[model samples]
Target: MADHHHLHRSTKNRNGFYVKMKFFRTKNGKPEKPFFVKHFKWILWFSLSFYFFAKFLNNHESSTNNNSLKTSIINHSHRALSESILQKPKTSHGLLNDLKVYIYELPSKYNTDWLSNDRCRNHLFASEVAIHRALTKSDFRTFDPMEADFFFVPVYVSCNFSTVNGFPAIGHARALLSSAVELISSELPFWKRSNGSDHVFVASHDYGACFHAMEDRAIADGIPEFMKNSIILQTFGVKYNHPCQNVEHIVIPPYISPEKVQSTLLKSPIDGQRDIFVFFRGKMEVHPKNVSGRFYSKRVRTEILRKYGNDRRFYLKRHRFAGYQSEIVRSVFCLCPLGWAPWSPRLVESVALGCVPVIIADGIRLPFESAVPWSEISLTVREADVAKLGGVLDYVAATNLSAIQRNLWDRKLRQSLLFHDDVESGDATWQVLVALSRKLGRSHRRLRVSSE
Candidate 1:
């Protein structure tokens, strides 16, 4: 019995020794016998346990390193993807380079005789795109649809949304995609929704009367399709409307600076500051009949000038700068009046020039926060209250010129809301545009296939 037990123990020790030799065998050496045969039982058990533990640790280290390598490769690949895809010609020129897009700029009938109030007359004062092209030094090539990376649809305010058939139905769709109060939810009908990505409707509220009304219709008609197959909705407005979470207010490129404009006009003394009071810096021509509330100009401008001209109590000198910044710096205040509703390019330029802007329009939605106090920065004048106009101007003249000048340059509201010449709004806009472009491209390919 004792010999039987001894044999079993010997057999177990021999197997353990064989395993250890198999693992540790060197290229130049033979298998070595157990160093301590007396403690063979304890050593065999310990060696077997140690072998498995060591193997587990090696495997764990190798696995950790492989996973880290895989993660690094994935990160590097994603970083290169945007740059590579953007290099494709399809998405160049403010359009996503890798995307296949077709932009059709819908020309308005008002463009033909934009200067004449008879034909181009609308509730708005300014002429349409054709007029803008003639007046401003904008490139006519921008409207060439063949050269466009994405279809450009110029949306305007019409009294009846459906009655206005501005664009041809064969290739393009009317812009009914406004991101306003009426359009902000998931619970909406399908007909109003834009189904494919091929068409992107930029719901901009830059124009005064058209903003709220057009966007209300667009949201009601669009939210449903946006849920299924989304189209890009680029909104640029001061007021935040429906589905504020999804809508991205694209920054409008700042207008040419007074210095650059002066250079273009070839005026001398470009650096010289012009301080002229109450400059009528916008488009002068207007249709008399369509003038309503904010759209109508109440001859309060003439009244203020005429009143100040005769007033001896305060030596108020009233003068017009002919929309020229050269003479604008001559006056302490730049009287910026809104035409019908609340938007005018003069307000933006006035602030940029470090002049105190006096807003005369009643319903003009103030852009800056009420807390930081724009009263410290600008003057807000009521449209009809000609009585308070003098008081407001007097108050502006009383404030410290250095503080006001400093506020204009260092102002957070002005910086955040307004666009500067150096900063490009293209990147954020491009991100949204790319997503929509891909969506539209996929839709176009799918439609082609289905039709086939």
Candidate 2:
């Protein structure tokens, strides 16, 4: 019985040992799926989350860099544009830098044929040549009207007036002016651009004021109806009373022949003692029945002749073309009386010869008043003050008179009153061009603001 019990115990012990060995093998071999298989879905979720987060960070950095680059480019462009705007206007020959003018091509009958006529080749035709030459020689002319700052109408009103049978054919002149204006308005896009504001017309004739002929009144009234809105470059820019008076219109100097100008310029400057105190040469009386009638009949000339004809201090002579410059050079002051018009070539001639001009014309508008101070250079007398002419001049201090003479000899002032071979900065033609440029720039600025 003892032997049987001991064998049973041994068997139990073997079974226990086998059971422990099997448990150790299963634990060691399988490894429990590395502790992740128990929560496999959670592991996959964490891995995918990490990958997407990393990708989003990379894209954000790239976008920030691109935005910064775009901002830098925009800022640079704005700065460049601002600098360009603030820069000074470019200058060429000291006038308008890049200003362009386009001259309208009209039929010869309108301008060329009449201007080329021998009778019209005097002072009446001078402006046409000088203006054309200046514009052509300078860099300001453009063949295309679209590129031009000003549209120049080269019709010579004075030349056209000469074409008619009678000298002062008010009806015929008006018709011709109206026709030219109508043709340009109808055919070109430029005239209608600024309602003819940018278009320039020359009417330097003494009868320019008569462009608007009133059949009943028999005189020019204001400006021609068609030209009221246009820029009229005229000699008849009278201030208060007479027609063709406009602030918008430019008053131009009369055309003195280059030959006459050269000869007068060659003379020595006025020095020491000039013999005559004042000089007058021209028609002392006019026919009562002239076209302008009482308007042309300036009694001031006759009154002066009557008052000072015998006075040794005041030299008075009937109209004589010869030795005119010699007489002017001999005089201290030249009398510029109103004749047919308020403006005369004599005023310019006196200025050329450095003689102090005693202006007696009523309502006269001097040229280049902006650049040249006429009041400082010349003496003005009223039409009613004819008897006090001597007293008026005598009242001026000798120091003041000497100063006026000195100012007349100034290179700049003399050049401003005349035309040059090349269109210079302060010359009459250049001054007109500068005025036109300013007008155009203002118009352009207005357009830009309206568009914005």
Candidate 3:
């Protein structure tokens, strides 16, 4: 067969060139793993679908940029706490703008002899340790109305101390602390009165003695606009001479209490049994017919009880029972009559209970800065000299009451009737009540040019 048909056509052209070189070495030649594992499983499924579509578009742009930075910090903290509670600012110098009045806490409604059995029928007669030494440690029930700039508050409630009911009762005036619970709970939007400002009352002592007997019942019962029409009233101490403007003491806290001489109502003047203690009681009117200092204090207490009638240590008290500490430690002296005149509280509780006060009264001013060393203590007298009170009780029976001269006469009677020793009239009445509360927080055309 012509060489067997050329060796069978050269073994069928070398077996069809080895099946086309194994299909071009598995489609192109080198990368061959079982046909290059079927084209490497379509290039690993298009590279895992483009790496999960770029990780789902970068996690949806990182959750929309973390919810736009938490809604821009909650709308800038709700527009800064709502413009700090709507522009808060009522007086105290539009809310403390450099105000400096320095500590004061008054809280009145007096009466506290376990709620009264008639202890000095209160009129704001102090004693909570003289209102904690006049708020020096700052507690006035609990002060801090934003570190006060003005706070006198005593429109008049009167304290007769009673609870099983009988005379002008109601009490409690709070504020022990915690910033007075944001000042009496209004949450201090600068004590709003439309941020205009006004607050201060302080008039008592019979409405600063006749503000026309309570100014037409405080302007037809509302007490002349209670507060905030840019408030301003200001009548405190020296008053009652009536007939127009001058009143202004207001620096309170000396209603007697140097720990009322360690009170427990101080009884032992020899365990009392009336060794003569008499601070008046009930229906008192020693003789008030037309009160010309009433029949000379019962004709000078009946000539000192007819010159000490059988000397049971003679006595005569009243001013509602001389605010007791055992009637001023079984008093050796203290008559202080005036039956209510230019001054009272018997010239400050018989010179803060070391006793020896006599006074009598006629135009008595005697608070201090002048004739006070009364030969060491006190004994005024004159109301047309009640027949020279038996020669001033024979010169107080020839003087002899010493306990180291009654502790140097109770330290010169607490430096002349303690007004906390005139700290410059309590810093000029707290700078005239904080300049009339910044002149009623101006701007009604500056309060009509400050009330003209």
RMSD list, candidates in order: 20.0, 25.5, 28.4
TM-score of 1: 0.41
lDDT for 110 in candidate 3 is 26
Report the Cα lDDT for candidate 3: 0.40
> Which whole-number lDDT from 0 to 100 does residue 299 have in model 1?
56
Residues 1-452 of candidate 1: C-alpha lDDT, one tens digit per residue? 87545644563687655555554554456544444754798989998998687667656655676433233233334433544567542223443343333322222331232334332222222222222232122121122222233333333322222335441121112333332212322222221333333333433233322233233343444433342333334322344443322432232322334233334225433224544544544433333223333323455555455555455332243343444654444445666664433455556556645556777766444542322356776777776775576676666567676677667654343334332222222322233343444444344444554688
lDDT agreement of model 2 with the native: 0.67
Give the per-residue lDDT of model 3 (tens digit) for 363-426: 4444332324544566667767755654674566476545323543544445444433122222
Candidate 2: tens digits of C-alpha lDDT, residues 1-452: 87545644453587654644543344555524344666899999998998677557655654675433233234434533555578643345334646777666666676667655554545533675567657755656655455566777776556544344545234455667677777777766666767877777777666454453331252535466667677777766667755445436777887776566667556744453578788888878643324544534357877787778888888888866765877777778899987766677778778877788899987787888888878877999998998899888877635588888888756677677776556777887888887776676534334554689
Q: How many backbone clashes does candidate 3 have?
A: 10
Candidate 3 TM-score versus the reference: 0.25
Alpha-carbon error at 262 in model 1, in Å? Answer: 7.7
How does each model score on TM-score?
0.41, 0.71, 0.25
Top of the candidates by TM-score: 2
Worst 10 residues of 2 by lDDT: 67-76
lDDT of 3 at 91: 24
Cα displacement (Å) at residue 16, model 2: 99
lDDT of each: 0.41, 0.67, 0.40
Candidate ranking under lDDT, highest first, comes to: 2, 1, 3
Q: Sort by TM-score, best first: what order?
A: 2, 1, 3
Q: What C-alpha lDDT, on a 0 to 100 scale, does residue 56 get in candidate 1?
A: 78
